[model samples]
Every structure is written in C-alpha cells, then in structure tokens.
Target: MAKADNIFNIRGRLGDFIFCQRNGKTYVKRYSGGFTKAATQNHPNIKVGQERFAQVSRYVKSLKQQLQPYLWRQKDGTFHNQLMALFLQIAKNETEKTFNELIHELDSYSSLSNKSLNKNSKIDPSTLLYDAKTNKLNLGIIPYELAVKYKDMYLEVATGWYGVDGEDILLSKPNIQYIKLDKQTKNEDVIVDITPAEESQTQLPFVALAVVYTDDKGSESPHLVHTVMACFVKMRNI
Candidate 1:
C-alpha cells in the first residue's frame, strides 16, 4: 500500500488501484481482489475450523439454557460469546476430561456482573458454605456496602449440572431460591434451602449465588444483579 497525497482525495477503485483510509490517512493499493466462497470452502484448515465451531456451539447452547434465568436480562451476547470461547478451549484439548473437570474450569472464571460485584459484593467462593446433604447454603454475611446501597435487594441461590455421566448426557434444570433483604444496621448472615426435587436430582450439582436489586424505575438490566459460582460437587461426593 502507498500513501495518496495528491489533491484528489479518492476512495474505491480507479483502474488497477484501490484507495482507502487507514488510521485517518488516505492510502492507495493494488486491487489484488479477495478470497472467493469456493476458495474458502476448499481450504482444509477452514473446513476443520467450521466443524470445531459447530461442536463447541452445541456445547455452549446446552449450558447456556440452564443459566437463562440469570442471563435473560443481559442486553447483548457478550456473555454468551465469551462462554463459547471458553468452551472452545476445553473442547480443543486432546486430553480426556471428566464432567467435574469441565465444571471446575467454569468455576475458575468470574461471574455475570464480575466488575462491580468483585469490587463491592464481598461474596467470596472460598468462604461460601453449602451443605450437599441438606441442600442448604450459608450466605455468610451480607456486605454492608451492598446492604446500604440497595436496601431492597434480594439473594438468589441456584444449583444445577450439565455434562456426560456414564453413557448419558446430564443437563438438569437449575433449582433456585430467593431471600428478601430488609434494611439492616450491620452485616447479617443468611441461609436458604435450595433442595432439588427427586426428578431434578438426576445429575451432579453446581451451586451459584447471586444478588438482585429491585429498581423502583422498573429497569430490566441484568447489570442490576450480580452472580458467582459458589461451588460444584460431583454426584458421587454428594
């Protein structure tokens, strides 16, 4: 490509040259054309990429549905797209991995409202307490800042699982419980039961904890809520 400094501030094609703008500067280059659909389809690497993408897409779709309650209020596909990329990394690995290993990978990542919650929520996964036997979560203590900022907020505790177990692929619906928060002078500890029904207990379990703020203005933004993966335990361990 060559800079176009002439008086004619040109763009598009003129004879064998093509003119365009780059970083606020005008430039001209040869019209070598571009790839055709047939060329792209015939490329061996591109075909493999297409197949890999399809497989990863299916995996992401299965997992995204179980988290729809927490994700529906999102304005864009940012979370879905990022999740797809994360799943792709797992799918590309050649080493065989179990379902619990896959859930661990997800647990290592941040939650939906990671930015604001990480700075203010104070709900640490390490400190999170859950009793698999009773299906109860001890929501240690409500953060003073969160309590004061959103006095009408509530907590959402969820549990579910998705992945292969033996010859079957388990994708169970999440069991959620909500606890209303009232005005408080100090931090308070809260516990709630999220026991899955007999039918819902068909798979392993992954627990999630979240805070939802009730907006008086009736806004529908998912940003008003923050969620984190509290814990995951294999069915055998449970």
Candidate 2:
C-alpha cells in the first residue's frame, strides 16, 4: 500500500478562513458562509487528484515563510497566533486605503489646476510633492504660501534664454496671470506686466520676473527649448 501524503485540514468555510503564514495563524470567519464555493472552484491547482488538499499544502508553505518570526509562538499557542493575524490584516488594509486616497486627491487637484492653465503646460504633481514630503509639506500637497515660496523649485523656463532673471516677478495671489511669450530669439522670454493688476497701496517697485535657467535637464549650459506660459505662483497669504 502506498503511504498517504500529510494533509492539513482547515474547518469551516474557506473564505472565512484568513490565513496568515507570517504568524502561522488561521482564523475562522464568524459571519458569511465562512468560505465561498467560487473560491474553492477557482483556487489554483498545484497537484492533480487533490481537491482542497493541494490548497492546504501550498498555503502552509507560504505561511511558513511569512510566519517565520511567529512560527514558534504560533505553534505554542493558537489563540495568540489568531489575534496577531487579525491585527496584521487590519493594519495592511488601512495602509493600502490611505495611500490610494492620497494618490486620488493628488490626481484630482493636478487635473483641475492644469485645466485652468494653458494647454501646453506640464505640471508634475509627484515631483512637486517630493520636496514637500521631506519638510512640513508632508504628502506633496502644496499650501499657497509654501507653493509660492517654492515656485522656483517646480517651474523651469524653456532652454536658451539666459540672463533673463525671474526673481522680481511676484506671483499674484488668488488669480491666474497670463504669461506673454516673446518668440524673438533662440531662447524665449516671459514678461509679467503687474502694472495693470497692482494694488494702489503697494509700495514695492515693479520688477521683471523671467525664467533664466536651472539644472532640471542635467545640462550645465542652459537649453532654452521648453517654455511654459501658464505657470502660477503659490502664495502663502492672501
């Protein structure tokens, strides 16, 4: 007679059984059918002539590696293993949902903001958030002042127009300013005429704000090839 292969048996519905290999823990679902017939039918077949037997074996191996740290404890106490498994599942689900929400918010904001700008503008939300993530900016969400403060960090003029400095241009608060593009030379120039939009009480002298050059393209020499007109400054205060 052929010797029987060691088979691990799990009671109750398969779906209700939350298996955590990292902790060698198995949980039975209190609600629902415990296991779905569809899940059993669709389960991967690792060996022929084995129904749930193959699944159990494969699951055990996977759990062994995942539960290496808690293997000993799990083997010693079933209750402890179950509790740990449930906690891990809950934590993982929450983390996944949080990250998904952040990405969705960023995408929605970028789309709305960009749509308000000119058609040729390229605003990379991920790149914008990279620096903010390290400092108080946190997850790439740019506050008005912070955005204005870091305006130079995100916007780059098209290459070739050097000597045209943009430090003097004050990004107007609460409104979109149209950037007039001058196509007279190899490098383009951005002109911001704040005279029409200036407040009567303002005392600061009007300054010319132009995009000169930056290290965005890994070139030591300025390449005046790309020009962005719809760029807006993020202000901290109104």
Model 2 local distance difference test score: 0.27
Give one digit per residue, the lDDT tens place, for model 2 in 1-238: 1122234434444453432222343433444343477776666552222533333344334433433321111222333343334334333444434322322232222232212122222223221211112221111322222233333333322211001012121222321132212222222222322223343322221111113234333322111212222222221222
Counting clashing residue pairs in each candidate, in order, gives: 0, 21
**Most TM-score-accurate candidate:** 1
Q: What tens-digit string does per-residue lDDT give for candidate 1 at 62-148? A: 656655653343334356676676656655562354333443353323332122212222455543455667776555554344455
Q: What is the C-alpha lDDT of each candidate?
A: 0.53, 0.27
| C-alpha lDDT of candidate 1 relative to the true structure | 0.53
Worst window of 10 by summed lDDT in candidate 1: 112-121
Which candidate number has the best lDDT? 1
Candidate 1, residue 226: CA error in Å?
5.2
